[model samples]
Target: MTALSLEERFRTGDPRALARAITLAESGLDAARPLLRAARELAAARGAAGTVVLGVTGSPGSGKSTLTDALISHLRSEGKRVAVLAVDPSSPYSGGAILGDRIRMLRHHGDSGVFVRSLASRGALGGLSARTMQVLALLEGAGFDWVILETVGVGQSEVDVAAACDHTLLVVTPAGGDGVQAFKAGIMEIADVIAVNKADLPGADRTVRELLAAQGLGAHDASTWFAPVRRTVAAKGEGIGPLVEAVLAHRAYLGAGGLHARRAARAEFEVRTLVQERVLRRARELSGDLYARVARGELDADAAADALLAGA
Candidate 1:
């Protein structure tokens, strides 16, 4: 038996190849550099702009996975190939993800048109993995109609999804404390689309009302988008269409130039993160046992950082 090449499987839209690409992407291996370049090349050749990337984020147990499953059903019914990149928590020591997100999406199993994959956060913050952007390039190039990024546990101060996505859906529920905290966590500015999931519960309407008010106050710029808060009973598949419609409408709202600007901005963010990672790696290389010294309070962090930068 012969092994398949990345190009062969990629051209055929093989999910196995896509999974392999994502693994290599996350590994940060030296050879992964060319894989990144190859992904970019293929994405450009395929005119990857046809794919839309939507990010979903909210507090844990906010029904994010359920909403994602519902949205996948909605998108696939319309004859679209949908892929989900669910970023979940990773074991601190082993770096292996429990992958509960994909577990929640088990209903989509054996469906070729729907690709559900979970990537471990592996200590990466901002609710997304560092390699996610690269994987999106591969997914878009492979011809997925929609790539939904379900971010890590979103709570107070996890606005990282704001940078990684073209459009973001901040999922909030009709629950008690979360509804109030949502407003404080910088959600008003981050959410392009607001999904109030579990709308079947009591107080759903009130949550919507308050979210609308928050949008008003948080609109800081008159030109900024006022996110629409849609009610969704995701477990029952209710309001998924409207939610999907809201996402597409947001895309339409971002005309070609708006879309292009978003892509460019996201690309710039990825590049900046990569450069920072490299610089940090070089700093660690030069620092030797400085981490121990800092930990023991023998050397102050600012001084250690200055020494590291001086060497760089």
Candidate 2:
């Protein structure tokens, strides 16, 4: 289908169209470029459904996926249509997702209101797959009422992408040694809500206390925002409701802060990142022979960098 037609169906709540559009958006640039550009323009005009974009991030095996699943169920049961974008690390040689998020969400497959997408990190430097943002736009444009973006990375880069969402929920487990410390300094800075998963475990309270203490160290600029930590037994669906409520509250807080304007700014940033990646990827692809000359000392690094900039 044409981009316009696909977008029309997607807006009308056609699940298949949304899946196809996202698939096209994830694949090669030549085939998906026109559609994505058109979608981007349309999104600029129509904008997001004012959907609450909630992000969940943490170290692998922190019960993030499980917590995400519980949260989706909670939202769905409340009559909200949900969209999930799960970033999975790629197998270096196979170039496929290490964790099959779609399979993990199999229980929701039969539900039309829940759309799940598993995206492999396409060797994107910052842990986020390059096209993940575009795919997010596609999902948002497809009429989802609540969108959840889950990242696989545990570092600063993951924190960066999670910031794009309205409320970022950082998942941490008690079992991971120094997990509380891992959160307090870097990744936790961006969290609007923190979930200490495996709350049924013995050390969960200690972990929560540590996070609270670390949070106390940061000067809460009342003018800005504050992060709140909540304990959750995701496997048992213990705290999903409170988590969802916190997400809604954060949405209200951000909306009052003029979130629409912030989203526009974020869109601008995403566009720049996309363009930069494209240019750099193209330079690498087209400058093979020139780089061979460089390897033979025929061209220097500065000259090559300058040449790439000139083309850009």
Candidate 3:
């Protein structure tokens, strides 16, 4: 129960210890600082630097959860330890994760090599929980061979997963005009691999062609990594092997230098986000009358924000 013992258990990959550490990280308490620091150090010492952190994202009804479940099975079959962080929309009243993903992945519950945790987005703009990065570091430190991040259904601007993971897998469906939507400027650009799930449905081939055409329209050259569009019927576990192969191919393309660059970008994003969160919290605490002034039209919004920051 002591901090040192907890860290020791965590180093040994104790499941309970990992769970406790993640809860502390999610709490955002000052007490979590040393634990998180130790995790980072342990990860580096263990040579877990090559651990793949895969991000799965898409709009609602895209079968992301089902695809993730298949991935977990495939990875586990290969004798690899895998951890999944499923980010779900927060409940308005309780501000807790809906737990839908956990329920769907119940078959993996007793597997020692598989760890799945659901996180509440808590109003984060990018469909990811603010504590996701820290928790991901803990998972890496816990020695999982792979870490999968499944984001809440995302839109064009909710592509933060690109900065948070080694590779971003954008999932789309064959029906519902998702093919056109997937080619939009923002989300499409971030995808390292795109999965057209529900391939058994109508328009599957058309969707594939549209996605391939969209790739052609992008400003990609021979040196650029073009996202591969693969079709899958995740519910039946069909086409998952090729999807996994595509992901690994993308990883191979990234190479060592490119992977390091992506991790560096992820580190920068975490630092900036933490700084912005702290500053906003401080500003909120000090804006007793500034909000009233703005509401009363006594001070303009921009000026009030400046004053709040100054005080913070």
Q: Name the best candidate (by TM-score).
A: 3
Q: Which candidate is the best by lDDT?
A: 3
Candidates arranged by TM-score, highest first: 3, 1, 2
Off by over 4 Å in 3: 1-4, 44-49, 90-96, 121-126, 155-157, 295-297
Residue 54 in candidate 2 has what lDDT? 78
What is the lDDT ranking, best to worst? 3, 1, 2
- Please report the TM-score between candidate 2 and the true structure: 0.85
lDDT scores in order: 0.75, 0.73, 0.80
lDDT of 1 by residue, 109-216 (tens): 888998877776543333344576677666766678898887656432146567767788988888885666788766657788999999999889899988888777
Model 3 per-residue lDDT tens digits across residues 12-72: 7789988998998898767667777777776556442557889998887898889999999
Please, what are the lDDT tens digits per residue for candidate 2 over residues 1-312?
555576566656577776787787777456556556655565555543467777887777788888989888888889999989887653445655656544778899899888887777553455455577778877766657888988665554455566456678888888864356665457778778888899898788888888888877777677666666788998788999888877777776766445677667667756766777777787977686888888999889899888888887
TM-score of 3: 0.90
